[model samples]
Target chain A: MTNENAITVKNLTKTFGDFTAVDAISFEVGKGEVFGFLGANGAGKTTAMKMLIGISKPTKGEANVAGFDVRTQAEDIKKSIGYMSQRFSLYNDLTIKENIVFFGGIYGLKKSVIKAKSKNLIDELGLHDEADKLVGSLPLGWKQKVSFSVALLHDPKIIFLDEPTGGVDPITRRQFWEMIYREANNGKTIFVTTHYMDEAEYCDRVSIMVAGKIEALDTPKNLKEKYKVDSMNKVFLKLARNIE
Target chain B: MSISIKNISKSYGKVKALTDISFDIKQGELFGLIGPDGAGKTTLFRILTTLLFPDKGEATVADYDIIKDYKDIRSHAGYMPGRFSLYQDLTVAENLTFFATIFGTTIEENYDLIKDIYMQIEPFKNRRAGKLSGGMKQKLALSCALIHKPKVLFLDEPTTGVDPVSRKEFWEMLKRLQKKDITILVSTPYMDEAELCDRIALITDGEILQVDTPQAIMQAFPKTIYKVRTSETYRLIKDLKTYPKTHSAYPFGEYLHFTSTDENLDPEELIHFLEQKKHTQIEVEKIDASIEDTFMELTHTREVNAHD
Candidate 1:
């Protein structure tokens, strides 16, 4: 049995005056699946993600995110998904508990529920001793963990993480993937974009973007086998080289 | 040796940024400082470049003492910071010339030094640095850094945010620079990049973990590992962590890199165990150790040792 598509984009295109940022890209992300969007710098990965997350309006085509139309029903779409990026979204000055409260409040969670969930999350991430410390003082790895937990505060059906593990150590990055695997098991669809090709291997299905077009899309193993390469980095290089 | 550091230590207030770090880079060799954020790669680089002082220990770059010969060191060493610090409003050509003039040299005087690298960005020489693409900016930065023909180059996370294609190009440029017999010291968080270096120092939390050729480092790792995947990936990882024979289990790209304490452990036994757990789509394959695997093991042991 196939999983229901949590996201669907058909001929999705976004333009800025003369330039087409996302040119008629079409794909569907299955429910609870980890979808990897791989691309180089300015490959329109961010622009495409922005459109699907209901931030930027697509110049043409259609996208149904969590069953809401990106154009006509952006408000509803915004209510159902979470987002975290390299330029951390949470307030740095706030304590971990306070940050959770503020983010949970934005999601309209009740005060009591927020308090309980905050406690649980803090404990689960092993931040109990550091719960009251300002987020700015925490290490990058720990900070990322908190931001990820905060993004899940609303229990959104989907989360869009843009280079979530950038500049982090391999151990922390490996741990972050474990968190992602846990979330995927919990039925949360993850739509992630990264330039790190090794990360492509972690995704259940990956789509490569180059010069505003979907260049290749397949499982990491299949893509490697088809391209006759040993690693995803080589697969990405091969695709990127062909266009350049 | 192009660069040699002895017992280098630095501290920021109460926090130690680097501790007892010592290494040597032979002439024209590419050395990588491999670590995560807060690993003190930046601190060591700054100290070597004479941008900061170490609280303890000593070092030399291009045969100049980092402490007493700060002036001479500045003239003979080039540094590309983690961030692009070139003038945003100046065109690529203008930035190159400005750097050249400040170094008391002319672009023509050091033209031969940066020729190959500069040629890549020459087409965009008139474009403002801010207007250039990431790859272009990186090249422009390298060109400016080399305009004075410094004997040693220090690049801190030069490819951190660069595209894979540009990263490949930048490393290729580094290879060419190495042929010029200029020692290069680079720090990067990406583990796969360690393989490109002639030798690498694995650092974490401001201390050196190990220093050796990437191949030798991986060869030193003592583990029999398998890449395993099942339909229930999350649960399988948790279950495998508790498996009696398992040494460690963590997520790899598409599968879990499972290491067992038992060297001659049979794969069939693990298969039968997973089969009993009713997991579907089970696939297991043995794979060679990667640099990352070695780094993780070293750091993990260090953490456990610190705790004890």
Candidate 2:
């Protein structure tokens, strides 16, 4: 295992009865690299991500995340990585400050550390005025931003974001990418999945999953040249049109 | 007009869902309401479809008053809510039949209307709606919505979380349906999809920002956009935002789309500024604004005006 690699997977596979969700996929992400994982709906990207995050065990193969064995040290891997998804990330009913405190505690941070971190997080987000307000009252963009900050409260080595900008406006979406870039610049490995093809171009490297296999994996520039396309959207359309 | 909304306002308790929303959709025109979540799209749709009444203002669907001719509007409008509202327990065929029957029509009566969309899901006709994949479920929902051959179709973010490929296919379907003389009013959070509509209304925070053809909106962009590229995107964006003349700087794909507050901004001066910052592999060129650029500018200016 290379010390510079944050995540390593080798011929990982997961099956349900007769259905093969993720088929013998192999990939490696280096530390501090922004990796974009993309696929069509039901293309096994979620299954592959679940295995990498140490929640769902692979039916066959070996994988490592954050210097821990995925199968054996699943609990440790969970503790070492941060995850935020569009569907479930924060408690809407809880105030912003309370949600931060609760997530900080869940990450096993000391009370004093949590208090200091929450203050910094609120100030950084310019949400000091809305700290005591329920998270549900905040706009969708603000909620997504706050949830992302909460995910980083523990300062995990690698963070996984699932469709973080699914329905965000163009400006907020770019702001979210800026946040991702800042985290990457600070030496944090970012694993992200998004349906936005333009966003796929923002990643250091991207892998496109088809059915249950990775059909293409390369930098956006290389992928564009290889596919003879001008933009990532065309590359995606050409790749996805193959099945139909 | 196929649908018309005048000063439509709706509020839930203290939160104004839709404020002074007004738009008109011509017969057989494919119109889009483009906005993010919580932008009052669904509330406006509900009012237009006669399912809910607006606190103030008047609307008509298929030339029938929304309030007085509610039953007529209900019959003339086909609504596909954002969330799949089909019966999960029923099979694909049964769900279509149920919708057809409720409209006092039969599948055979409107078979031609949904043939293109229905055929795609016919193979899974016996499968339960709950067991269908995301794409399949969308197709089924769309088919059910069209069972009664509505005059005006209201699709509320039908492709919200759908993949790019499926989203493309869905838009193609709408285009074909539009050719059948049905007025379509669809809403989507994706700015890119706005181009597919004959006309679009950019709505945000319960207010309509702009309404025009996608091309016109881009052409009307008030600032000269510059595509700035360099080795360090993050640093370039940070520096560009801090520049005194910076109007708006947002990351677009691999490069940053920057606009200067000074009209007739010189690219050479910007290049020289970056050169002074010790940046390499720099490229700066004037580029046309896109729909997204226009949308961001409108919302940004709106925020600034609100603060003032």
Candidate 3:
């Protein structure tokens, strides 16, 4: 478990019944890096993330997330990493601030700290006027931002964003990446999965998963060069189509 | 075939969905209504298709007032919703036929228009629509939408969940359809798809941010662009932002698409500075701005304007 690598996965595999959702795959994400986990729908990106986060079990593999063995130290790994699923997990009935407070309280933040953090998060997101507004009343982009900020409330070492920018506008997606960059600057690792190839270009290094395998791994530019494609979209298409 | 919207506004209960949104679609033009989810694209489409009436303002699709000539408008306009709302249990052929029947036409009447698309999925036409792949479903949906030989078509994010190849195919079909003198107004969140449109209106939060040809939008980008590539491109992007002349720096593929406040700044100076910082394999070159870049600039400029 080295400090340089925020996540170390070796021959990781996950099976559901008889089908292997995540085949033998190995990859590493450096500390404070935004690692893009890219794949098509049901391409095992989510399954791999689930295993690393310790909620789902791996059939056969070895992994360390934030220097904690995912198998024996599931609790420690969970405590040290923040996760925002593709689905909006915040309670729609609660106020924006209330959702933050609720998540913060669960993470064992002090009441005063939660309050101050909520205020800061709201202001930073330009949602100061909407702090008292119900989470359901906000737009999808705002909800995504709030969900992201809440994921950072516990100050976890690694944050996993599963298609966090899904259905968001290009402007909001840019803003969301800014927030992720800020967190990365603060030395937090970001592991994100997205179907958007343009968004994948923003990551430090991206791993393209196809048919439950890590078919390509490199900086977006290198992958493009390797695939002899101008765009990441083309690189993905080449790899995905080749695998098929 | 011209469509115009004047001072259109709509609300759902207390929520203002759209406000004074005005735009036009020229005949045989591939117009794009670009926006995110809940950006009132569907609302506007519904109003123009005669499914929902706007709270205020007037709209005409293909020279017929949406309100006064709802029946005529309905007959001449084809709409594909954001969600695949076709009958799931129905076979692909059945769905297409049903839509054709609803429009008082049979598949054979307009078979030539959808023949290219329909032929791709003709083998699986007997398969249930729900059991088809995303790409197949897209083709089937487009075929169903075109079954009536409509003069104008409104596709609400037709390529949202489809694969990259399917998206490309769908756009090609739209281009082929445009040859028939059909006015097309399509909405999508994918910025890349915006370039495929003849003209696009970038919308956000119930307001139209910018409207122009994709080329025009790119040309309007108010900054000199540089593509900065290096060994640690990600780190370079972060470090470049701290440079005094940097206005905006974001990772674009293996390079950083950076805009500098000082457009006259030399690339040699940047390379030297990176060299001084012990950066490796650095390459800086002036490059063209993309539609996404233009969209970001427009949105940011609008936000700054609103704040002011």
- Per-model TM-score on C-alpha atoms: 0.97, 0.99, 0.87
Candidate 1, number of clashes: 2
Candidates 1 and 2, the one with greater lDDT:
2
| Candidate 3, A100-138: lDDT as tens digits | 989999999999999889888988888878999899888
Ranking by TM-score: 2, 1, 3
Estimate, for each residue in B26-145, the C-alpha lDDT of model 2 and write its tens digit. Answer: 999999999999899999998888888899999888999999999998898899999988999999999999999999999999999899998988999999999999999999998889
lDDT score, candidate 3: 0.87
lDDT of 1 by residue, A1-244 (tens): 1468999999999999899889999999999999999899988998999899898999999999999999999989888999998796678899998899999999999999999899889889998899999998788888888899889998899999999998888888888888988899889999998767878888989999999999898888899999999999999999999888
Tell me how each candidate scores on DockQ against the true complex.
0.76, 0.88, 0.40
Worst lDDT 10-window in candidate 2 chain B? B237-246
TM-score of chain B of each: 0.96, 0.99, 0.93
Answer with 2 or 3, whichever has the higher lDDT.
2
Off by over 4 Å in 2: A1-3
Candidate 2, clashing residue pairs? none
Order of models, best DockQ first: 2, 1, 3
